[model samples]
Target chain A: MANPSNNYYDLYRHGSLGVALTDALDELIGQERIDPQLAMKVLTQFDRVIAETLQEKVKARLTFKGSLDTYRFCDEVWTFLIRNVTFKLDNGGQMVNADKVKIVSCSSKKNEEK
Target chain B: MSNTTVGPVYDTIIAEVINAVRVDFEENGVDDGALEDLKKEWQHKLSQMKVAQFPWDPKPEPQAPPAPAHAQPTAPPPTAPPTAATYTQSTLSPQSAQQTLSLPGGLLPNANPMGIKPEPGFVQAEPAIKQEPGMQPIHPGYNPANGARPTAAQRAALALESQYGQRAAASINAIHSGMQINPAAQPQQVPRPGQAPQQHMNPQQQYRQGVAASMQQRMQQVPGARPPNGLPAAQLDGLNDATDTASGPGAVHPIMMDRAQIDEHLHAQIAARAKQMEGGGLMLPLKEATKNRSLPEKPRKADGPSQLDGLDDDVKSEEDDEDAINSDLDDPDEGGDDDEDDDETMGHMMLCMYDKVQRVKNKWKCILKDGVLTVNGKEYVFHKATGEYEW
Candidate 1:
């Protein structure tokens, strides 16, 4: 099933972008310092920033030391589960049974042998 | 069981049973005195049983230690042992605590197979400080000694103070100053009698008054300034001349007439009359002559006798002649006998014969039997051939 278009706060509330910005917004609203409209505007800007960040193709090198066999990506633009893929380790062995892994970067280069 | 093994167990069991029984008695409305006596008896039996079971006292015993004071009359004596066990248990750690509890004297064999002693004092102290890992004491940041963070309400109040406090104070000061200055600038009004009260005149009234004053001043500055009277200038001139007798007849005063003027006016009137008489004498006689020649004389009879005449015979004769002519003209039969007959038959037949027949039929109160029509007491037969009722 295709995922519906969601704003940054919606995705962020589900732990996307590694920050609880929505919780901060909730606290602000709860204290009545900012109204829902202002909160929504802030959320919209955050969403735009997140969408732009996701769209940019940047070179990043990551060293993952775990055994995670399955991973999933979710957001407004992309939503899919990744599984059963081989990953190279900086220390010379591969792990396949990790529970959680972080995606460091994406590049067009083929895997290089050390 | 051997006395060494059963001594603490028996003491513990007996203490628990006494406690249970005491609780049951208290719950069932046992008086405090009876409960105390029962508690003393149980303590004596428990001490005696401990003495009988363990002759070799591990610790030096007082000759007769007073019965252990019961903090709660219904709590077991084994409660204290658990506190000691917990102290030991904490020091020995889990591995050694398990080894200690696995010793032969453990009360619950399979339940605590590791032979860990129950910390009964922990139960008493449970409400004060729970032993569970998750039940750690919460150190609230709002301690007076440490300095407390502001609460949400206090923060909101502070924010409002920052935002509007100065403005509110300034406004209050402004109001105070305005109140202080207002009375000094205002004039106190005192009313006076006999002076016509000053009415507030609107702009329109003021404009009208200004116009009237200007007009009065202009009038006063005129060369021959007249009193502001109701009469107009032209009328005033005539009035002045009329009242001034000094203006002689030759002077031609507007009101006074001259004798030569009267004579001239009379001569003009006489000439006008003479001219009118000449025109009328010539035209009128000619008009009368033409009229008398062209029109024939009307008959005196056609004019009829005057109604004002006192002669009754002439009036009567004229009225008789008028009646005779009117009667002769009004007679429609004069036109034709056939028309007269038609009008008479059509106009009179329905009104006379049909009405009389309808009245007769209405008048007849009758009933018919066979062909006879009965009316009142008379029986009349309907004759079809003659189309009439026959007796």
Candidate 2:
């Protein structure tokens, strides 16, 4: 009868949080006009966003105040993000493929001294 | 009945009767023409009866001789006790004859209630009473409540029963607590044939205690332990999902199809892609057969994008790119199929691809601001709480 603050345990039992987060992030990334690489860095910093969100939701009482990568405890945050955020795109919008953005590397031309 | 009616009303009544007859004939399988003739005959008889004036009285039909009526009931004289005289008289009573009626060749219940005027010699056949196969007839009269209620003596017995149960429970508890060490001591005294040597006991006990202590510590840490920390509740689902790959075909997530789309787009960019698979509707079985056919990969020389044919060719190329990539993938032995390889690389290329896509789709700020964002041509209208928009 004890409901854990994050209910990560129940979420794990019922569904895969990682798959869910991957799905949510795919939708979020697809809709953004920003560079895909930067979008990823933002998603990687989800712990910070989660911590801030939880602080707001809980009014700072149940704080997930911990360092990035150190909060082995924030698995619940990942679970919460996945369960609450992952969604299908409107009008059947799809995950943006990195291949869609072809990387065309060009070297700068130097002025020739004649 | 007055016979003054001589108008459309008579026609209406006749029509209604005809309709009713038709419906009854359809429903009940009676001939309408025959019933109509019978109705006419009945009407003719009624008219004659009316002319003759209603008969005041009718005579009752003659009755058959009521076979010797059974003897009347008489109260049995109460005797001092069951004596020989009363027993002999009881056997000769008319009630004893009634009991004999239950035997074979005796009266059976009516077989057909619908049949009228049954023949005298007709014998009723009893319906077969079907007993459920392999099932016993449960005695409906049996009651569990009868056993539940206890007399004084029964209560005393129950008290003894509880006393014994408590004694047994206490004995079990004592053994569990190591109070009764008879089983343990016997091992040392008798040196049982398959028992481990006593020298190993101390180490084994220490190892068991270590295991138990570790398990208890884990149970306590589990609540606070973060995800992937080996906590029972940790969100190690990513690890779990990696283990299962042989799931059904449809089990591949829709996201995987999007991954496939990368291959699609790459193939579309290729100019020399050909339309291998047919596009229009075909019989389902034929289409399925075509899908199954393992046609050898057609080797096409790669030409530059300038080889693109026409305006329609652009659209066709875009659609066929996916098929081209897939066909290219179909034969991995060929050095070609770089398009598909590019698709496989897309996952690593965009790290936060999924996360970014999710955020873009989500109108979080709008929800936070309690407003909406309208996207127009080259402009974003941000409507706030005041119901106004700004670029």
Candidate 3:
């Protein structure tokens, strides 16, 4: 019953775990193993669960600094292409470095609907 | 701090999403086994993405559960191609049957429809050189246009048979001819070709010419009212056409010969157009549009440019934007679906929710939370992230 309007963003479906789940569901549909309507129901549930899990379960923090290459804010999503980025994980002081990184961030206000 | 955290985090998301959708699976009447398969297949695909270390990766149990589901996905693709191939063969069968019907000899029970007609001119068979064999195929092809009309039950039968081959049309015609009124025609027709193939081809031709020449002589004599000697004008016209094609030697009677030519011409044209419609016609308009762009312009101008776009772009585009007669429909794409650009690149991305985002001129800062960051072939999971950058 929780659709896109009242529920969490389906935006994360573009992520790796979501993409993998979608591919799996598509294979099931292609085999006539599951109806396509059921696959959509599963995806809607995935949007709620992944958003809830990430907000509640995760605790570690990281800081990153970069020269932003391109930035666009359209609809409720903010997209940034950053160059020469450096990340410092607060847990153990480990550093991950990259030449370029693209950040896609959604509005946290939408998820705090509870 | 490390890629190790991603393994358990992803495992949690996977288990949670699956548990949530379980009731939906039940309501949809999908088996619990499909739910089980979805989990295994999901993990299998995620592992294939190799985006991070996962709890399922080190153990052999992860590989064990997906083998059955993996094999299932592979099986249907092979079956899919055969279905498409058989579809093409069915659609082409009728046309192929029509083509064979048109050819000259090796006439067996092949022209059963023609043979069933008990064609009187067919009585002078003599291998049916020119006009007769054309009658052979044209008659069978005629069945399709005919087949489209029959009673609903016959239509259903023809439609089903039409899938396998057009040979079904011939068999259906044989059934149709034997049904009620014409039941007597087939019996005498069946064995007559053996004895009748050598009969004289003279009586029909001589009679037709006798009528026409006598009409001509009478036309000169009377000069006021010319009659076909009681023969219909259509019959007289047919015999005149017959005199031209057979040249009085091809063992074809005048009446049957002219009608066959007319049917042959119509069937050939209709068959050629049908073939074109099936083959290149689908994507043809684009090709024709590109090749003959000037063709419609001429007729359109002569008939009246009342058909949209009267004013040329070079002359009148600046008068109004809405009235601009643009030649190409290169309108800008509606909305931004721009994020997919990252999918084509080497993976180094983070997807998150921003708690607070601020901008001062080009300087920007954002507090992002509950994020998945994948960079340098490693995935990092975090509850909160702070990013500062200048654009």
In TM-score terms, candidate 3 sits at 0.45
For model 2 chain B, give the 10-residue run with minimal summed lDDT: B134-143
Q: Rate the local accuracy (lDDT) of all candidates.
A: 0.28, 0.24, 0.56
Give one digit per residue, the lDDT tens place, for model 3 in B1-391: 5766778888998998888888888888889999999999999888877767788887542433444443222122222322221122223232322333343432332333333223222222223322223222212211211121233443343343434334464565444433323322222222323222221221111112122222222223333242323223423332343333233322235446557545544443454455455563455566543433322333333234442233232113223322223434324321222344445333888989998889999999999998888888677888899999998
Which candidate tops lDDT? 3
* Pairs clashing within candidate 3: B93-B166, B94-B166, B101-B137
Off by over 4 Å in 3: A1-6, B59-346
lDDT (Cα, 0-100) at B321 in candidate 2: 48
Q: Per-residue alpha-carbon lDDT of model 1 for B114-196, expressed as tens digits?
A: 12122322233232222221111011011110011123332232233233543333443333233323222211111111111
Say which docking band candidate 1 falls in: incorrect
Candidates sorted by DockQ, descending order? 3, 2, 1
Give stretches of model 1 more than 4 Å off: A1-13, A16-19, A61-79, A84-114, B1-391
TM-score of each: 0.18, 0.12, 0.45
C-alpha lDDT of candidate 3 relative to the true structure: 0.56
Worst 10 residues of 1 chain B by lDDT: B349-358
Each candidate's fnat, listed in order, reads 0.00, 0.00, 0.85
